[model samples]
Target: MAQRDYAMSGADARRAVETGLAAAEWYHTDIPRKEMKALMARADQPAIRDTGLLFGCMALFAGLGIALWPSWGSAPFWLAYGVLYGSAMDSRWHECGHGTAFRTRWMNDWLYQIASFCMVRNPVQWRWSHARHHTDTIIVGRDPEIQAMRPPALGRIALNFLGLLDAWQGWTKMLRNAAGRLDPDEADYVPEHEAPRLIRVARIWVAIYAATIALALATSSLLPLMVIGLPRLYGAWHHVMTGLLQHAGLADNVTDHRLNTRTVYMNPVSRFIYWNMNYHIEHHMFPMVPFHALPRLHDRIRADLPAPSPSILAAYREVLPILWRQLRNEEHFLTRALPPTARPYRAELHRHAPGVPAE
Candidate 1:
């Protein structure tokens, strides 16, 4: 295949539509209506409990960090706080934005707002952005959210662990939005009507960050920022680790999620912090399912799915080589084998997957 064009308004965008890949109907595993209905059912209790735990830990850790500041003794507490703030909030922003975390709309909206702020994402822009992500996942030139674009920027991915590159981009985008201009890529997916709201939120975020920086300057200490902004940098590792595995090294421009996603079993703590998103395939297939119900959903649907990686490390073992290979081939990607119980991939679409090697 020609070198991939990942830009939404580029030649590949036209090619994606011409090839019938953009907004194409995707394959889904079969499930009984009753069972699927139950799986999709929403509730408040689980999200309420999880949100409480998430923020509760943040409070406890931040409290201890503050109480023991200016000492190495406080480092662990701040580290823990950073993961919760930096990593945990990413999942919270995702689930709440999907409106699957809570049955109550207001609760989802409230948490989405808070989590979006923590993520340095514009709630209005990201809501639309994520909607487009679901609509055209991994379709090169169509999916604005494809993380590991062809000839992936290996260095940028490395810097993301420290939130440096992403923070710079995020801050720049926030400022641009605050100045009432949507970046070209952002405008491709974000609605013009929503621009005002996104701009307003960006202004609000600028005010908050400015105040936090002023407080840091006034006190001549990094403590204020530790509570407000620095965690997004220092504590971003876990989320970056989990988030990359969602589609990294997997097939792009394919309709079958089986070819494009991974589901890795993770430790309870990582699963909790990542909100069970390690069930990546299932989440993509059933975006309406609440995070609490994902394990059950996985059990219900696993027979038709490819086997999940036994652990996060196992997934890394599987993904790292593919990514390394892709750096050389650019078009190289992993092709997951579905179990015999699974329905065959949609033949017409799978037959034409660009750059995918023959099985």
Candidate 2:
């Protein structure tokens, strides 16, 4: 297996375009236009109810944690708060960024901004970055959000559980953007017109973080920092665990979502926190469908998708080994075994030439 470059400026990106993999037409399950329209319809009720639960829980946990500070009782409350703030916010940011989480445009933007702050992601930059992700998902040189690149950085992935690497990179990028410097990869996806807005948002984020730090110092307590800054590091594991199953060892540079994306059935609590993003293949196939409607969408397209992993544990069982194998054999990938009812994979149309393997 050759060492394949995953950087946006690398040869793979140029190859993806030349090979017609970048922004190429992808496979979609056939559905009646009227039925699809109904599924894609945005509604306020579901988003409203879910948002209420999320904020309500965060308030409850934060209040309890604050009141019980310096006591063991506060530990559980803070733990709960961290997961909601750090982990759940990832999904919220994702769905809201798509502007499909709520029927109301302002509602989506409001939550998107809040969640982006919680996750330490620049909303303006990620909006464009994610658009590229959807346009060229898992394409080696195109998608900016490829979570685990091959000959996988095992150490970095481990540190990311504590949000160490991601926080460092995110804060560094934020500061750079605040300094009016956009990285080449970012400039590649984000429009020139959006650069000013991105810088402004980054500056605002830096100011808020500075304020939180000052408050912590003024009080001679860690409370403010714990509340605003630290949870992203402490509570990131759940999202990282689930997020890794998405495309960790899947084929890259491929046009088919089924080849690179995964759908794992998770428990009810996980579903709520992940905003139903567990139905990842369904979400990728029809991004316009709201998170609340993913299960219904999954049912509609079940016969056309690979058999979903029965649980998160099941997904990891399959994914972990593939990742380990890829450490030595970068060309190796788990070709999802689609069900008999599913559409056959177009192997010939794969980005790699016939008899040549894709990285």
Candidate 3:
């Protein structure tokens, strides 16, 4: 496998455009119009109920942790709080950024902003970034959100478990945005008109973070930082764990989601934290469908898609080794075998493509 640059400004990005891969049409499972409409329909009730429960749990965990502060007994409560505040917010930012999480526009916007802050993502920049992600799925140069680039940066991936690399890059970008200068790659996806708003948002985020740090210093305690800033580091493991399963070892520059995405069946608790994104292929195929409706959408398209991994453990069992091999072989990737009941992969479409070998 030839080493290809995954940077937006790199050769692969240019090749993608020249080869007509960037923004190319993607494969989708067809559904009846009425059924698709129903699936895409947004409702406030489900999001409201889920949001209430999420916040309620966060509050309970935080209260317990704070009351038992400076003790080992607080560890469990803080751990729960960290997962909710740090890890769970990643999914919330994602779904709400799609504007499909809630029927109400303001509700989605509000949560998107809040969750973006929790995850240390710039809401404005990430909105367009994710739009590009869906539009270009796993196309190396075109997709900004490819979690693990080939010849995997294993050290960065390891540090990202604690949110170190991600946070460092995010804060650096935030500072750059606050200075009203967009990095070239970011400028590629984020519109020129949105630049001002991105700057303003970044400035606000910097202020809030500064305030949190100041409060922590003033109190001579870690409570404030733990509440606001540190959870993103401590609680990031779960989301990173689930998120890497999304596209880590999958084929890239392919039109088919079944080839580039994994759908893992996760437990109910994981489902809640991940906002049901484990139905990843379903979400990618029909991104308009609300998160609450993904399970139903999965059922509707199950016969047309690759069989989902039975569990998170099952997914890792397959992905981890592929990732390790990819360290030595950039072309090494998992070709998800589809059930006979599922539609055949679009092998002919990618037969001549470099780096994307047919299974």
For each candidate, what TM-score against the reference? Answer: 0.97, 0.97, 0.97
**Candidate 2 lDDT over residue span 242-282, tens digit each:** 99988887888777888889999999999999999999999
Please provide, for model 1 over 1-359, each residue's C-alpha lDDT reduced to its tens digit, 9 standing for 90 to 100.
Answer: 67888888999899889988888888898888999999999999999999999989999999999999989999999999999998999999999999999999999999999988887888998898898888888888888888788788888899999899887788889999999899888998887888999999999999999999999999999999999888999999999999999999888878878878889999999999999999999999999899999999999989988889998889888888777777888877777777998887666655555464423
Candidate 2: C-alpha RMSD to true structure equals: 1.8
Measure candidate 3: CA RMSD: 1.4
lDDT of 3 by residue, 1-359 (tens): 45878789898899889988888888877788999999999899999999999999999999999899979999999999999998999999999999999999999999999999999899999999999999989887889999888878889888998999898888899999999899999999999999999999999999999999999899999998878989999999999999999988888878888988999999999999999999999999889999999999999889888778999999888888888888777887878778888778876646424453423
List of clashing residue pairs for candidate 1: none
Q: What is the lDDT of residue 290 in candidate 2?
A: 95
- Provide the clash count, candidate 2: 0
Error of 2 at 128 (Å): 0.7
lDDT of 3 at 75: 94
Error of 3 at 186 (Å): 0.6
